[model samples]
Target: MDLEVVEGLVTAIRPAANPTDDGAVLLPGLVDLHTHLREPGGEAQETLITGGAAAAAGGFTDVFAMANTEPVTDSVERVEWLRAHAPGDGAARIHPVAAITVGLDGDALTAMEALASAGVTLFSDDGRCVDRADLMREALHRAHRTGTVIAQHAQLADLAGNGQINAGRAARATGLPPWPASAEAAIIARDAVLAAETGGSLHVCHVSTAASVDVIRWAKSRGWPVTAEVTPHHLILTDASADSADPVNKVNPPLRGQDDVRSLRRALVDGTIDAIATDHAPHTRQSKQRPWIDAPFGMTGLETALGVVVRALLEEDALDWQLLARVMSTRPAQIGRLGPASGRLPQTGAVADFVLVEERSPVRVDPSRHLSRSKNSPFGGLELPCRVLRTVVGGRVAFEA
Candidate 1:
């Protein structure tokens, strides 16, 4: 398959003679509303080029980059630098999500209006919660006024103190600190109320607990402007899998219990959970190799996102492709305010971005083949039903097989 791009827009998709050689399905390009392109500092873990490649390989054409890097992205200058420095790889388009507060410090706020004028539609302090209710409310007010989104990491630091794993059996068995669901739920509940009252756009990042889902549902029922995302890892894995204390499973908002997993699935199916973000955190092996407690929390996710989703939701007959497109593409585009139809079919004579998913053959994941600098992927050795045959972003062949 060949995709032609001109001026960064897909001009034409020249098809292979046998386009459906392996029963490939053309999907609207996937959009990840949450991804960590660890650049400017964590180059050993990931860079713009490598992270973009990973997103292309995973069938994503657009990704909302989290602002948790060194010299956190909080200003228009940093945001402009990211936009101009995006690698010319024709891979996923990187949308900078600036931090909501200065340095993510939770005290002073960033120039939200100025950043929005610079074309940043989303703001977040994803690795930390805005613990101060007043600050959070002010940010929400600014967001409502600017029509932008404030994505929260949603963990109450005081409640989740020094926790290394979920507060279930896995925590007990590992003898590690417990990360209770209350820690995440409490923040979601507070933010939901703030969003409703202030009429601001609130996006909950990586909904890992059932309580979080319940709160989001209630917010929706109340007709509040709240949207939530669930990570591919959290939707499938459980805290039970964390018993080994393998740092690969260590993530913020920690993998949850079985009920949470089930609830997340149901929420996704029912539209209570809006998008399936990869939360594609890339951490170097030397760092991930540390004892679970001391290791930085993250895992490489871009390469394995689609396969995991297919195996967990599609293969299990829990969701169909249309709904999958909404969760992975359409809704994310809407929530992130990333102009219309990112993962949907481009109208004829319009520029396009999309992916061809080969579903007839199965393939096992291999961590060594990851394009990211980090090899901390959790899907290693697992065989799944689908592979991305190609990804065309803006009519260019970003990745092909």
Candidate 2:
């Protein structure tokens, strides 16, 4: 096969001849629809350079950087700046999602047309819910006109206030206010209606509740343009882990119960959930080493997502390779509107963005070894039976293990 690099772009085509028949599974490089790069601010925790490197190492060729940064990406200038300033050497391509509201305050809407022209394909008020119904409707309407997707964080501020974990026996046992599942389901249901009414694409981010999955399923049955994602933590871990007071288990849309995890896995297998996004929120060690209540809500996920999927879903044959490709790469690329130029698949003319996996290789998760600046994964030390051996972006090997 001939691999060529032109003007910093990599392209991979048919090789001359096969020397070794090493059975390596070739899949499209993963695309994370939701990630917190923390650049343009919050650099102490993570910067574009470090986060992009981590993404490449995790086998991702493209990542949608959420706009909830220090300065908040809301304007055309800021969006352009982010796109131009992305780390070019990283394994993954970085696409910036502009905030739906100015400063993500949920007060005034941003310039949808200008941001879209600046290459912002997704808009979100993440890290906080857009509580104003009228404002949300307006944002959806604008997004529809611009052909951009609005990704909701799906948390009800009132119900999720100071919520430490999922609302269940686990939270009750810990004396922490529960983050009721209804808090997420309600927003998803409402947003589905808004999306249907406005004919806009609405994507629910980090969906953690069984009821939320049901809502998305119902919406799809009606042909509403709505999609949802499930995080690896939610699929594998439960609020029961929070009983240990380990900050690593803490996250927004907090780790749910075993029942919820089962339901999420079922949804993933049945195509009820559209994709698996990392929501890769990184925090410094000092930030996560505090009391559970005081600790930040997030965990670094890029490097461990595939292994988690293999362990939780593949080993049981719950999801096959095709389904994994859809959830991890195809669906996310479609949702983000990141065309083939940004690494969708490994077609002849397509950008050579793909990952090589040693399907039988065993993996031991190690936070310290992660490429991300933060080491806050709950899955650290957990062994899985597969590993991402190499990640190629534009036909260039961005990362190799």
Candidate 3:
């Protein structure tokens, strides 16, 4: 296949005169609905430039950066600052997500209308849930009016207080505080109903439990405005991974058991889970080097997400490249309101954002080679396939291998 490009757009798709018989596949650039480009105060962890590089390296053309930075992206000024600082040379497009509540305190709503007018399509108090039911309901109603999406972190602080790990054998074995599956499920249940009640679009982030999948399935069964994303880690890693006193395994919504992993994989393939979002949280090595209890909950994923997902799903024969494209690109673009039908295939007049990948022997993950500022990867040493050969954004090479 040959793509004719002119001025950052695909002018035509024509058959090559002499196609090289390489095993490489060309795919639409992946889109990530959840990524933490920790700038402003957390520059020590990650910044826009580094994070964009990581995204491009992983075959992503677009990323929705979460609004959990130092000053918090609750205002138009911060949002604009983020847009202004985004790399333009040859990096993935960065969509700045605005916080749902002022200061992410969950006490009051941010200027939703104002932020949406500034081109922010997704709102969330990620890393912290909007625990107040009244506030979430109102936010959902407002989001509906603005034609935006309300993404929930889906954790109940009260129920998940001081939770250190998944509430099961891992927690029992490690003697750590247990984070119950109900904590995530309960919030999703409430928010699904609220979304249905208010006719608002609700997105569940990093779904990690079978119970949560069941709730999402039920919500979708009702045809409510509810969609969900599963992270690469959650789809592959079990809470048993946390059984060893490893802080790298610590994460929000903490990893679940193998049963939950199986359920999540099934849900993704069965269409109950809508998309695959990285939730690519990055933390400083110094912070992560502390005691397991004191270290932050996160892992850098943008650089390794595609490989991890490929390893997780290909084993079941449930993931064809088309399905992978849907979960990674098409569905996520739709959820982020990138376009009416954003993640389109390369065609006449389409934006030239796509990737070339070759299925290769399993390659062990090495965080030291990551483009991100932080090196808190949970998949280090894990062998994964599907090496990205090239990534293009706006007809320019963003990454080449």
Candidate with the greatest TM-score versus the true structure: 3
lDDT, candidate 2, 112-181, per-residue tens = 9888887788999889899898998988898889899999989988777878888878788888778899
Q: With candidate 1 superimposed using the best TM-score fit, by how many Å does residue 131's alpha carbon deviate from the native?
A: 0.4
Q: Which 10-residue window in model 1 sums to the lowest lDDT?
A: 1-10
lDDT of 3 at 390: 90
lDDT of 1 by residue, 1-401 (tens): 55545665656666675665555677788999999998877788899999999999999999988898887999999998888878775778999999999998889999999999999999999888899999999999999999999999898989999888999788899999998999999999999999989999999999998888888999899999999998889877888778898999898878888888889888999999999999888888888999997999887788888888877796458757788788888998888887765657655456767788887678999999888888998778889888999988876789997
Alpha-carbon TM-score of each model against the true structure: 0.95, 0.94, 0.97
Q: How does model 2 score by TM-score?
A: 0.94
Clash pairs for candidate 1: 10-394, 10-395
lDDT of 1: 0.87
Identify the candidate with maximal lDDT: 3
RMSD of candidate 3 to the truth, in angstroms, is 1.3
What TM-score does prediction 1 earn? 0.95
Order of the predicted models by lDDT, top scorer first: 3, 1, 2
lDDT (tens digit, per residue) of candidate 3 on 237-289: 89888988789999998999999999999999999999999999999898998
- TM-score ranking, best first: 3, 1, 2
What's the number of clashes in each of the models?
A: 2, 4, 0
